[model samples]
Target: MATKKLRRSAMLGRVVAATATLGLVAGLAACGSDSTSSNPTTDSPTASDISGELNILVSSADASDKAFGEVVDAFNAKYPNAKATLNSVPNDTYPTTKSAQLTAGKVDIFVVKTFREMPDYAVDSTSEDVQLAQSGGLLDLTDEAFMKNYTPSVLDSQAIGGRQFAVPTGNSYVTGLYYNKKIFADNGIEAPTTWTELQSAVSTLEGAGVTAFGIGGKDTWPAGLVMNGVVGGLYPTAADKQALTDSLWDQSASLDSGVPLEVLQKTQWVFDHAQKNFSGAGYDDMPAAFANGDFAILPDGTWNQPTIDTAVAGAFEYGYIPFPASDNAADNKYLNGKIELQLGVSAATKNKDAALAFLDLFSSKDVYTKFVATSGFSSAQPDIEQSEFLNSITDITSQFEPVWESIWIANANAGDAAAYPFNYPALKPLGSDDAAAAAAAANSAWTAAF
Candidate 1:
């Protein structure tokens, strides 16, 4: 596990550095959706011609990323005057492409990799990027009835100062433990409530010739994702260690400043416990192994649920559980999630009302139901019923809200340089056994400096 972690950590740096040194980095990485129907409205005196084409951009490596086409299709059904076109972009280049489009005013409606595209996404005020979007006159939904459809945290992601720049399309991706129900039951093992219990469960599975945890070291994000669970499990209160999650536009306290090194150090234990072959696995590989009952537990994201369910095809009984926090059952569950896959209206959109109308359609109960059911993701709107995946994910999110809120506050103060490492990249080396000493040294350095 330690070796795997080291390899993964090195791989991530190499990838980033390689992209940098080679000047191979380009903008706009993502696939666009297919053409959908354009619903043209009756000619209006007040608004721009309703029959003109509307451009909607979806980002991803795969041109057919699901929501883009479906959205266009739905929109075109009613607005015959509007036709939708998909623009596929690579993930790595998305930031550049999006920026260029914004500058050239070539985009009417498009998606941006908010987290990656924004340099100081979690912090920094007066960032030209955010300001540009705001200046473009974002479709303000503050007073719109659809505002009721989203959760506050979801909305908060797009909100700068008092105004919102985008509409939330989905909630954050949650990372936790997904276990095989039959494996636990057959072994007479209960779902672990503490790190110790979790270890015991893993040990039981390993003794029976199954991998204890199905981990993916490839697609580096999952490495961070799983580690988040481990870190959260160790420091249930770590969420609050950060004072702000909206630091990008504010001058706030350091999110990592107050956290004890001991909390961050617990990741060492998680590193020691991970499966031995983690280095060999990729994101897609884990669910395939889980379905085969090769592992008893997997630390991945809620987004993986759809794939997991499909892989198992109902042959196996599986359950999603919050990662345990140390050995204390009384300690609150800690959850790690991301605010990716959100939606924002084009600031330049001439059809503010129509754009908002489309956003409202996204938040509609029917859309929420369909999206969650199909995507295996959760929703932000509190009123929406919890799908099976949401039921599990939300339980953990609610359990750890206090921790996240604190982090939000701290990040708000510390900005990017401070907040990002506390949440990501910082814990990468801790999972490596060989790097245990290095991890300790890094932890001490961060703690002392923080």
Candidate 2:
């Protein structure tokens, strides 16, 4: 119920904005053929009828390749004549490359960060999906049978103008504190459920000469995750969260007042209590440090499960919990649930039948299960069970509220500026003056974007 409430409210602003943009684009692209069909049979092609070389563009992450490769292998078995090859690109360059490939009609299938990148290409006027359908740049799989297999809420979150443009591959519940269970046990410390308890734990850990938290502050984005998790706990409603975000751009709120000040204070606390030289640490170092028992907690996402497992090599136990933001447990109920990846068919592709077939196969329970399990992420498809590692976090994730990063700023570029502000690196020491200055710089950048 908490998850549903959070999702519904958090997604409203983006969805409404996208829907409006889509409407405007639809009006302008009236001459374009409407490729979006609500009729399931129109887009559904049987495996036997599908035959072609399908090229899929995706990020070059190892997990992505492994999971996609497995799906391709299974898909080949179903339709031997249909060959799907993955074209891997660097993660940082995906948006630019994907946009170029889509515009040139060179890519058949591609991965999207769902509401973020896909909407940009889908619509015509820098708007949303309806224009995408009207422009004939994206396929409408609203009535597609494979969609029935996914959780309705998860699928709907990716929808624009009441149409499904992509199918979600995996869900990530980030912004959790992964603690060294052995260290906690040795110190007789339980996972903190409230802000006061979390502070107490940090004090105890620090007094024991154990690092309270290990942060990849040099990477900057990790700092954003910490802020998001804290915001979830501090803000009780989606509107409350959105108000704070809007203030960053609109200048309605100041860094020294309300949520902004609170966030700065909390960030200051984490920085004050984190391991020495945390600001000098890199992203890769955090997992190793935590696994080696150098720290009691590491703030990160569910995606790190495999990395930690590999680092620890079964030497110690660890578990994740939502970052506590408030003294009241009721207010501290949320997790950073994000749809990490979504598979979409290019609207300009000539191989529509093959693309449709691949989508169907990819969304099938069997294929999707293997992909999610291999990636060490929770399955967005309700019928497919999450991996054992993900199951361990069910205590937090089951009742988790969606993170602001996923809902408010799904676009990678916008997210970078909105989530990881400029001058955030300089604010590491957490002075009120420095935090205020950083917030001002970030707000200016956001305003310029608009």
Candidate 3:
């Protein structure tokens, strides 16, 4: 049972990470009497005026509890009168536990993955931060001084109708193709810049009897990484991608359309060429496999970097790049980027002053920087210097185009289809015809939902 629980936690973490990397729903327009239009600067209380026991809820899988524990300790030192406790829950139970706590008014603050997942706790509440502000379930922080420390664009992304409900923490670049430097060099293969080139490289590696790519297909979410990586490059622009999602939601888009079909085809290609028995492999197996030089590439996000490094003990070099999804260099240049985690205050907390103070401290330049740097995630605060691991991927990530997830995918009533394209199951067979049929079935389901 212990091993089973651990496996479930790992799977939950991968699913959450994948959603952070690939799932995005259009922001709902803010509505309700509680909407924050202007900065409520004067309403915020000073640190000394606040005092109470503050409880924070976060996932245990990513070492988030330890990182936030350090911040909580620092916060207590500044406001010695107030006490803060970190409640680290297993990733598999976080959402349900958070929801129960929120409904019971027992949680003072909580970690939010994306606005998209919030509605499950409060039916009338929308995932958009602004809508959340209007729902009266979250405290308005627009006027807070600490908010000014972040890049305006970063804060803006979390806003709904111009009211910020959450503070963005880490910048997540999902859908990266992490390659073994030594393996590629030994094969005389340069990083591919086009789909054709990528295919050629895969063939070359396969001919030499080396696994070209490593996948944890049994986990399901890892398989979707290929689809997410391809979709961004296929559309390559916010406007183009938005239009496609809109069409999809309205039943006007077809599975055979240029971008959708291509995404399905590429996903099938990857599955067909992955390491032996990939369908039975687990997520925890990939990093060790790649680190041991058993596979030339692993399709995943920066979240895996720490695990990969630990697995190899830094014995060989590895690098990341956006998956080259198209032959057109211009079209295949985007990365799927989003905030991996966020922090927000509960409106139901009796200790509102203490909650605000704690949030302020968490967002302070000193605390925020230390947390992000130590966690090895890219910072949302412009002034916080990113870790060396993040800096290494900046050249490719800097050129990222908007991913479709953040533009027009519907939440609220759309269910799982809102988070990921359901057609991915079809690609498990790794056949082009099977992929095409699955895409069509997914399109039909989406159309019915919309």
Candidate 4:
């Protein structure tokens, strides 16, 4: 079981975009009011007692798709009269597809990531999910019996105004590296606990005739993961990161200097030690590259462990650890994460009973264990059995620390770097500019918005 935190240190806004379908959402908002929008049928039924056709839609992920499928299979098995179907769309098309389905009244359960609150400076800002929820487009699961299966603290952090709308199936720790255990032992270096030690380990690995890091820069987001690791280490607490955001928003901070500069420089250092042409390398290729001992470290989310294991094929042992960005080991103990597979029952859903029943089945201890394990996500329920890989990183995940991605909302008016708010993409081989120059450009864009 993941050591449950009594409370999340902070809760932040969800990144907003996918605006093409906002019109469909707004136009169909009133249509969803007829049924199960706010108050669904009060009678809650177990799988065996409910009978209705169900359609579930979600964003695509290699592991998540498989897990949702298994849950649906179990739902069918348990609910004899239930006919449930899942449509997992590619991430690129998921938003549009979900909107299209909702407009057509074809989806029951769908994925949702939205704001419970906005920054003080942006009081009126809203995301697509916020709009959907406000427009009566989602069923409120606040008082649902199935929701009790999750940890109260976890649910509280995701709730808006004390009302829960989505079910967090699980989450993933993202601010860390997947290191080859054999490579570390062979190099006479243990997992580093400080920024200096990590730099030394990188040197030791490179001295042993190996690339220090393997990043899938071609896909872009993988490289961004390294930046997240840097931020997590430099600003180890929610208060620290929030202060930085406040300073930036008030024009009291600059990305080109202070800790922000350190973030850029350290991430640049990581990329510098990576395999040649890493920027051109594909994310799908890194697992095999590490499996073949092409690199000593791979910085990524825990969600990729199962995929990486498939490539490793039992050739070498690997462990995931916090990146240790700070000089103090104690400060780097927590791993930053974001909730994954958050499920919302569409107000437009016609089969409310079956949809609610399926969620009920999915939340049960035995079924959720299988779903989370198959999904490669950290368990969201307290006292629930965590997957073996999750168990390995229990030291870091003992605390519930939301990642900067989850806590920081991107400024739409700012340039690309400000969106990431780090500009890892603009540095070095990923782009033509050097780290300092990239940070300067990002600073300029961020400042212009002020």
Candidate 5:
């Protein structure tokens, strides 16, 4: 899992234009309502019994992963009428393995990670295994009640062409920056409010023989995050942010808008100036280096807070700030994130009520509180009181709420066929040159393609 924060200011407002360009496809829109009829009459005799077993599958590194066995035990304790067996697979093979099980009719529930590079946009985009699963009459979870608890963005992801399919699990996976407070204090650097100051700060750190920015070009997603968030950071106005987000979703909204170009330039500049081997560094490597003080600054998200907090053991001092961009004080902005992981009920499960009940269990105050406290992640449900860690994330997210609403929320390009975003990595290269004409041409090609 990625453990890095985006620049706090730009974190909320910033729209990841690059991710739009990447062309990574995942499942789409949720629609239709749950049927009131109990099991179609044609499908054998309906069982009156509500008690049955459901198989739940998820990607690796989940907080409840190692302890999921215990969570299942706890669940069984509370609901003796229902039982769920847990199955976890390493991220790399999850798509195929899970698909096979679903096709073979061996699994009942599925949990997918949205930010994973090759996201499963739909059950069957490129993989035959996924196709097999879809061919087996898997249920689409449009009408499940658990969906009522989700925020709009989470709901949007599940609705493909107005049809609901998946339920978003974790809250939006945020991206931002983390800086060593000691480095800023020792160098007499106030957190840079504008791009110019940001550049100067990095220069000072470099001159001091300290790596100023931890650039992880090797991990394409984080690198792309910096590039996209830059667009939001530099253009603080809601209208401008919205324009960018709109452009990403609706390519015709604008052409070669200056903000995206600026963002791309900033990313390239950081990559060019940062550690020599940054291009080869992975996401974990960059944060590990930052935690060790190998680098004074890192562009990441709240997800990494747990690891950093653990690594420093409270000895390392750090602070959250927006990603730097060339903007006046009035233009300085914060980008808010939506959710990182998504959860949904199985469409094909014979035990629809049981599945919904399980999801409801996951969303309960008790489970939510425990999950957020232990995971250092925020809750998507409005009812839950955010944990201390999530509270900090909320505070930061609140600062850029306007940007998020304008750019990310309103201007989402997720379903825009023309945007052609396959994944963040693929999109980053398209914007790499940072040339105005190049961007324009890219946008034009995108518009033409879809």
Candidate 6:
């Protein structure tokens, strides 16, 4: 916390704007479809060569759902006989759904987000992705030609045990709060950079007979997301977050006290001002509710912009800002992002060639550029022109700081409170217990493992 200013300065900068001309990557384009012609060349497969059913499963994020569809359509176009279909499951149920699909061998390509660092506590919570990769349930794409199309730095960040099992589709900043510009302009309130200012804005909105925040708490993760935003402000740097995690594991930290408890307090502030019965609100309905001016702010990730845009349909202008969960402005200056929507091929796929071909075509500059543009994700591939929405958020996104969820490893065997570390479900409005009770319960469960 003391070094936040230094950290912010170190991170503030422009995103790498690729100036290179768009063309087939010299070596990486060998397996990728020819950019100039759809017909086959000597170096590449013909339209009929790679033909089979290619089904991709990913957790639902409206923009990503469509961007993935772009790849499927392209694959179908290049290989007319090939059938590629995209299926999305809700985030809350994706794990079980993905596992069932993988067990049945119904999925070819699926989203993979795992703990690449593999912390000590991670063993209890090993993801299906990690297990698949470790046990060879995932197709190895380490030497794939299309893998060369991505930014090397992005690829390096995703590598597990010096190997790549998944392709990073694009990057996303998740700590953003989508606000109604019309509501703010009418209320004469600006984006808050500190907790005090955030409270002021909330009070003013309440005085104007408007709900301060709209959240989809029925799905559970949305309210939990506020704790994540608070964690970002509490610990701004990777070193700071990593140190906190180490402290927790080494018995030097307690969830009921210090920074961990602070995260819950700040998160509760958000829940306290949310629209009535938001705990019962469906995640799917928030976009339309926000567009109808039901609430002034919607805590969301950048990936939802395209969906919100469609829902808003010019009814009102909306803007996104990092959630201000701290008392210090510098701590809340930047949005934390993750190498999101990474995809990998299933080892059980009866059509491995088709899966590889889809990834090859999907990663090419020509196809990837349009994918990023429509997916509402920041370009993961270098030099792709950013969409207008991405450009609008450059002030906060110029430097990439990984989110708390990306940094901290949860203990699966721990109680709900110790598991997420914040335990938002135990707090009022969302639950019957208060912060103190929740934190105490967390300390109880957390200490049991040690």
- The clash tally of candidate 3 reads 1
Ordered list by TM-score, greatest first:
4, 2, 3, 6, 1, 5
Q: Mind giving the per-residue lDDT tens digits that candidate 6 earns over 1-450?
A: 000111111112100101110111121223322221122222445787887788889999777788888878888988999899999999868866876776566888889755355666544444546655665566667777777777775676667767777888878877889999999999999988888999999999999999999998886777766777788888876678888888887779888987788888888888889998988998889899999999999988877787789999998888888888889998899887788778987666777778877887888888998898877678777667787788787778665667777767655445556766667778877887777788888888878866
Off by over 4 Å in 2: 1-34, 41-46, 92-100, 117-134, 236-240, 247-251, 399-401, 407-423, 430-450
TM-score for all models, in order of appearance: 0.70, 0.80, 0.79, 0.84, 0.67, 0.72
lDDT score for candidate 3 against the true structure: 0.67
| Off by more than 4 A, model 3 | 1-49, 91-106, 113-131, 207-209, 237-239, 348-350, 398-419, 428-433, 447-450
Q: For each candidate, how many residue pairs have backbone atoms clashing (under 3 Å)? A: 52, 1, 1, 0, 73, 1
Q: Which 10-residue window in model 6 sums to the lowest lDDT?
A: 13-22
Tens-place lDDT per residue, model 1, 1-450, is 111122324334433433442211112111111111122222222323345555565567331366556666766676666565556577667656765664454566666333212325423323333443344433444666667667775565456656555555655445467888988899889988886787777678768777676667655556555545544655455323332233322424323333333344444445445667565568778778888877777876666677788898999788877678567765536465555455555555545445554565566787666665554455666656666666755656653232232233222222232333343344444233333343444334333432
lDDT of 3 by residue, 1-36 (tens): 001111223334544543442211112122112442
On lDDT, the stronger of 2 and 4 is: 4
Specify the highest-TM-score model's number.
4
lDDT per residue, candidate 4, 155-233, as tens digits?
8667765688889988788888889999999989999989999999999988889899999898678888888889999
Deviation in angstroms for 339 in model 1? 1.8
lDDT of 2 at 349: 71
Better of 3 and 5 by TM-score: 3
Name the candidate, 1 or 3, with the larger TM-score value.
Answer: 3
lDDT of 5 by residue, 1-450 (tens): 443323323222233422331222222111212432223212211224346887888777757574445556656666677778888888778766765664455666676432211123221212222221232233444555555666554455334435444555555444467889898888888888788898888888888888887766775556756654565566654456545555555455543565555554566677666676666787767657887888887877666777767776676678776676655744544544555445544444566666655665665567756665555556655556765555655544544233232134321222231131212233334234444544555466545544
What C-alpha lDDT values do all the predictions have?
0.53, 0.67, 0.67, 0.79, 0.54, 0.74
Tell me the deviation in Å of residue 200 in model 3.
3.7
Write model 2 residue lDDT over 1-450, tens digit each, in one string: 002112223334445545655443444244323454534754445567978888899887787789888888877788887888888899768766766666566777777543533333223223343345445556777888888877776665566667787887778876688889999988889989999999888888877889898888775567666777777788744556556555554556644556665765787678778887776678788788887888889888777777778898888888788889888897766576777667767665767777778888788777787888887668776545776777666555554355765444322223232334323444654223366666665555555554
TM-score of model 5 (CA atoms)? 0.67
